[model samples]
Target: MEWLPHAQRLAREVVRPESRWYSAVATVPRHTYVPRWWEADGDVWILRDGQSNPDAWLKNVYKDTTLVTRVDTCHADTAGIEGIGIISDGTPTSSSTLPSLVVRMYRHAMIADDHQILVTTGTGYGTALACARLGSDHVTSVDVDEWLVNIAQDRLSLMGERPRVEVCDITGPLPGEYDRIVATVSVPRVPVSWLQALRRGGRFVTTLAGTGLILTADKTADGGAVGRIEWDRAGFMPTRHGADYEHPADDVWKGAMEGEGEATSTSRYPLLYPPDAWDVMSMLALTLPGIDYRHSQDGDTRTVWLLHPDGSWARARASGFLDSPAVHQSGPRRLWDELERIRHRLNREGALPVYGAQARVDPEGTLTLSRGAWSMTVN
Candidate 1:
């Protein structure tokens, strides 16, 4: 397969020619790590096989885009020929992260040649890139799924680079200490285990679940870590303890989708998809954590729903982007009102406090995010 030129082009797009990671980006065969992947078409996931169409495979593999290799617990590599139809259920569990984002995470770590790094193994493509730059001995990769780890190790060995790949839950006790620990998966909070595994003064970089905040911190002397919410935002799938993520109960969503809540009002602002706005979503998550955001469009109308596990729900319907959404709220809390308060803050201050906020993780894994006088403690 003539894939070197494509990789070289990808390298140029993601890194400078003089950068240490440039060669790794230019040389690693990303396609080898993702022979088959799931591509989304509207609400359904369609399987794409590289062997069936080499041209499309090269196009997707070389592009600076993420490819979902596993949906729920079903890996595309093992999905066989029968898994080509539209799959509307379940969520993506594993993916080959975009090359640029992988490089961005590595850059955040300020990885030195001598620094040992622990990274997550998704498609093993990121692991391969790390091995190419820092050598297999300096890199250690871990994944929760045994099959994922086994296949990744085999691929790494085939490339003549065998790093330590283990089937371990990254949120739990790590296998060893390292100078840098970078997680491509987001977590609800900084795990105490991560702090314990990091060598003193080591750096850690990862995203927070339910938000698009990329946090970068350094281990402090007191067995804790201090850092800031980075201005650059990236979102990754939240870490799971088992084969798949535990979704909210169906009854919770039922109220949000069907019921006319206890209160109804017209929103002062237009309908905004929370996920599409990183800062807004981050502030909402910080203020009212555990709100599940959902949105759908029918013809010219757009409807947004916010469901909480505590039975609180909110729905907003708008005919146009600039039109005021008719909002409804139910349960013990006024969820839409809370969202409006956030929007009001943004309108009044021109910015949200989530980005660039100071972050501190206690030894017990509690995280506090503060900006100016505003503070939020996440346990």
Candidate 2:
């Protein structure tokens, strides 16, 4: 379609022409792979088809935006008109990640010529770009969903590019070893199997689950890996073992948000959700894992909820600008106080050292992170 040239031109604006990947981004027909996809309008998800609105479809594909192709296994390709429109009531399960972010991850990989690579096959748009830059023979892509793998393989074949696409859980045994591994999916921690599959001296890039931190590290001789967190931030859906993600028990969620805590106090700082602040969010997630954050607003009243699986939950509510938050802490730990402590520590230092920090993974998936005298571990 005529969209290729326009997409190439648009990509040039974001991905420099001098970049080795520019040509691949310029040539690959991304719209074909996302002929049907979901787009969120307000709080509802709506389906958009290339054949129905070719112009809007072309505009979307060429804009370097992510296209949602699947919602909890209800593939857009097969979704029929339901309710009043073509919509699905499922959370996004897979998408063609934004092209700019896709290339940005590749840029972090610092891939060298002749380096064999393994990458996640989301919508195959990124895989097509990779195959165009590095020959199909040197690139291997995988996805846990067999249907996605098959669709991507066929699409890539139609484009006259062929990469070994496999259906396998990336967290488990890899299809093969390579010098570079880049994942668009977030992992809770560095998977030990990745350590086993990576060739010594090979490097990998990924985002930690529940945060925007992007990490890149090389395999070490001790079956561990060490690297630095990139200053740039990116977030992705965590890899799914099945069609949907498992949620915390309904009662656990209810208690965390509504139940009373053992200790009640006022917060030094106003209520804030950790995910809103890139600087402290990663630090919070790394230091204390398994905390789910939620934010709600009622007029001037803003409430933030921090719920943990261990029956520990914190709720902070504030009104107006910069008002002190009424903090409630219950269960085994005081989470709101912990948030204040973390924020205070970072505020005292002028900035958190998450960027350019040294990251080390032990043999069993324990991540030891340190920058200057500040250090934290996540298992």
Provide TM-scores for the models: 0.97, 0.94
Please give the distance, in angstroms, between residue 118's alpha carbon in candidate 1 and its true position after superposition.
0.6
| Candidate 1: stretches off by over 4 Å | 81-84
Global lDDT of each model? 0.91, 0.84
Top TM-score model:
1
Query: lDDT (0-100) at residue 153 of candidate 2?
Result: 95
TM-score of predicted structure 1: 0.97
